[model samples]
Target: MVRTAAAVWCSASAVVLAFAAIHLNPTRSEPAAASANGNHAAVKTLQHRASQPHDADQQLNDVYRSHTCGAVAKANAESAVGQPGSIPCIGDQVKVAGWLEFKRLVGDNVFLSIRDIHGSVQVVFRQEDFVGFTEVRALIDKLPKQSVVSISGIVTARPQTAVTEASAVEIAASSLVVLNRATLVPFDHQQTNVSEELRQQHRYYDLRNPKLQHSLQVRSKVTQVIRSVLADEGFLEVETPTLFKRTPEGAREFLVPTRTPGQFFALPQSPQQYKQMLMVAGVDKYFQFARCYRDEDLRADRQPEFTQLDMEMSFIRPIDIQNVIEKIVARAWLEVHGMKLELPFRRMPYQEAMEQYGIDKPDTRFGMKLQNLQACKELLSQASVARGFRVQVPESLRSPFKKALPRLIKELALRNAVTKPFNGLPAALEDATLAQLDLVGADFVCIATGDHAESVLQRLGKLRLAVAAELERLGHPLRNPNEFHFLWVEDFPLFTESDTAQAADGTMALEATHHPFTAPHPNDAHLVFTDPRKVRGLHYDIVVNGWELGGGSIRIHDSDMQERLIREVLGADITKFSHLLKALRTGAPPHGGIALGFDRMMAILLSARSLREVIAFPKAFSGRDLTCEAPSAISDKDLADYGLKLIAQPDTKL
Candidate 1:
């Protein structure tokens, strides 16, 4: 049909006759006649006007002088013609303007389409309809795709052949004008495998592509929904300072130096401190569109700076925080995807999650659930703790690991070993402990044991993901992207032995698994000082499709206990936390909060490959902003004033 339109637009008089149809019958009570070939009789008159191109030119000039090419938007067109798969603004004449998305020429007519922020519409230009406006046709012919233009025309019900994204109705232009012109793009934005560097360099052009536009739009709407839902739940939206004191909140913070030589303020890793302070201030609830920063190793999913929907509440239980976040999450899914999730998402304790899936954040959509054979074998053992037998899965699946397992396990043991054990396993269960269980469809099962059980288990978890990916590539998709599976991984250990931290005797000392402030379980409070390893924090993490969506924990309110935690378990400076300690000592209520990775949520909502796709202007893998060429060296004088210096290294270094 586009080809036919191209052929029909060959003649130049199609616009001349279209003008007469509108002017001569501005409000004709009867419709124009259609011939046996489906061509309007007016089109026949257009052919007759072909002999007088000069007269056609003059008529178009008059129409151009008389009509206003003001503005009619894609949104206006959508509103006027709101039916699905079709626009129906027949007989309504208006001026529309937007970037020319497409163009085609036929016998004596032209078909053009334009796109604006809201949507796109098709414009039909009959040469006869323009009368003497030959310049209008000339303007279109000379312009490139994406040229901004305006058209004054009557909305006519399109013929059956004309149905498309523009719908059942189209504007038959009597006059046209170009507002701006765009140069041809060097490459197709539709190409999926475009180079990342090139796309980042030309992010503006990249965003103009429909895919990026759609993603940002949905992101905006979902954010609004989040705000609305939270507001309805009594969360007071608040803004906190970007420049804060250097307090330990994990991840490296970017420091901002002041004019006072050595003074510095650190950027927040999250609103963790401020939100907790809000709770101390007696604020019942608080939330913020928080901007967080971190100078960590970069990946496709990690950014130096990102956005999070951070919220906190006072006098709330772990379940209360979970319920609050669940509603917002469910609301987001409903508003963005129009699907209501089942209420009360599933729950799994941190240990169970680790035992079953090998990771705290488990993608529950599909399963290659892990089995703890050692735990099962303990009851069967008559002697001490069963140790040491390595069972590689079935022989078929075990062939690849000529020596891979031992090497990786050794590496994990060095970096993540909780305790160096006696390696004592009863001879009988030695083989079973290390034995890999051969499962139904899978070629083999993976099992690991050591002081670094969590570490080894995490490695096994990654291997599980890789295997699942391979199976999907081979035609069995275990984890479907379209399905969302959410569960709360609760009852996290209050303390874990940090690989680098050490006790007085030099053995690995206990450190806050989540943070120093997390309160221990009521029953486990006595173990905080005696056996930190056994204490469970009242914490929970919300996992969705295998991603750690968000996490929160009940906070410690007792100053003495907080001091004991800081000075003993974590072995940190109590003076540094004097402010938080004083606040806790004050009359404060039990409080808890959570911060959702808003950027990741956006990526999940749109199935974006990475968080960068959802961010407006993300930095490159090198942590440099390509668009503005950021992170450049500062002036020598400015550095000197800030009490900073640049070391002159050998020319061999970057």
Candidate 2:
């Protein structure tokens, strides 16, 4: 199921009350105001004037009032009722009254979905069912969604679990009443123009699809399960500001200009601050299924707006928070997929992870471990052949092997440049370097006719053997498909070199790897000023199947450290976050939190190629919705409503 971040504006209490009312009176009277609404008026008129009531409404109401709408009533009605047009049937001979949603008309029979009061109900009719009603055939051909009609037929239950099965059934029409006609554009007619995106824009019709209906239903259940699980764990489900003052986070904020003029409120990137503030307000635990917005590039796994299970707790250690999350996740898995997840999942340090897998979130399901070439360079050079093959060297220098050594070293350095500075090559590389290796012969060669051809060929063969051996070694068990590897990357560096290393104030500054709020290790406090690279924070990430599922850290609860960290590491003045600092001064408890990607989780659960498969209405890869035509040109009046103006491209003369 696609997990969508949709807010259920209706209160749960209202749903419960509505269900209760329906249960209390199965044959409840229609509202007085609805008496003149054509269809209801027809039913009411029949009920009031009939000397002896002969409609299905009167008969069904009688059955419901006497025995109620449950298994017992259904059983009694089935035993007492006869086949269509047969005598000794106590209930009135009624026709199925609904719109034909879907249809298949054979030579003399039809199978169609009828849009009844309760939703779509399937009805199957044979030629005999409407033998005397020629007009019904014409009506059936033109029947569309939301059309209202009454067909008098013998009611019976279906024999199997086919499309036409329900507690009640109808057959053999004595008459056809066209109560209301529908203006529906048939599905076939919209084939060229109706994309899924467009269908979402026209969600009313899209909801009629069983697949979408099931997906949305499952989504609702997931939300309910999340709410129930959190509430049970004594977590206070709180609402936070959707708009607030923007701060420098990882992503660009979606800004909403204010009526007050000049000032603006940024749609939340995540409820990070507000949830933490709950802890300051003495609320021990806080959580919200928050809608987060980011004005950034979109991808299959990302949206312009998304949701996160934002959570925070007071006076809790890192392990405490992890345990809470474990329980919540385990419960969610059981509820959603009916699977029990293992608790206390394995944790691997960030440094260890990069050294082994070259990725923070190592997909535990496979093994293709990265090896460090630098560690075993000397040993590899000593080997006449590396990995059982002769090493290849360019012929352009005095000593071909000696000259290429520098190039090889440069290549190794280039590979290391992309990863964290501290990470090194793996132990396997060292073992391979120590072993004598040879390269296999290449398919083609460049010959120097003036030189001794035999000697040149022999040397070239040696180089080919070495190259083949090295390439073969590089291709090993790391590429195996059967293994699943889950990893925990922790103790990430507190700061990293910024794009512009030199500060405007001529003071040294660095960019925070995670965020300024992350608390550095106590032992590394001094290094925060002297050598920022050496400072490690209490940060951790959960990586599974090669995807970073979530990340979090123990937050800086101490006000002084928070300000200093921001100024020293993030290169930002304290004034920008002064309000947050002030909140911390009010005796904020030690807190930490993580945000789980709900859409990504669903994508994993469904084994979907993209998050779009799980989503009911997702934009295209370019973030365009062909169905609804969203993010299109807005009207000038609409732009004026929000106090905004559009700036045309500089070169566009128009």
Evaluate all candidate structures by whole-model CA lDDT and list the values in order.
0.69, 0.55
> What root-mean-square deviation over C-alphas does model 1 reach?
8.8
How many clashes in each candidate?
52, 40
lDDT of 1 at 158: 70
Q: For each candidate, what TM-score against the reference?
A: 0.78, 0.66
lDDT of 1 by residue, 550-571 (tens): 8888888888998998898888
Backbone clashes, candidate 1:
52
Model 1 error, position 488 (Å): 0.3
TM-score of 2: 0.66
**Regions of candidate 2 where Cα sits further than 4 Å from its true position:** 1-101, 114-121, 145-204, 375-487, 500-509, 613-620, 623-654
Worst 10 residues of 1 by lDDT: 1-10
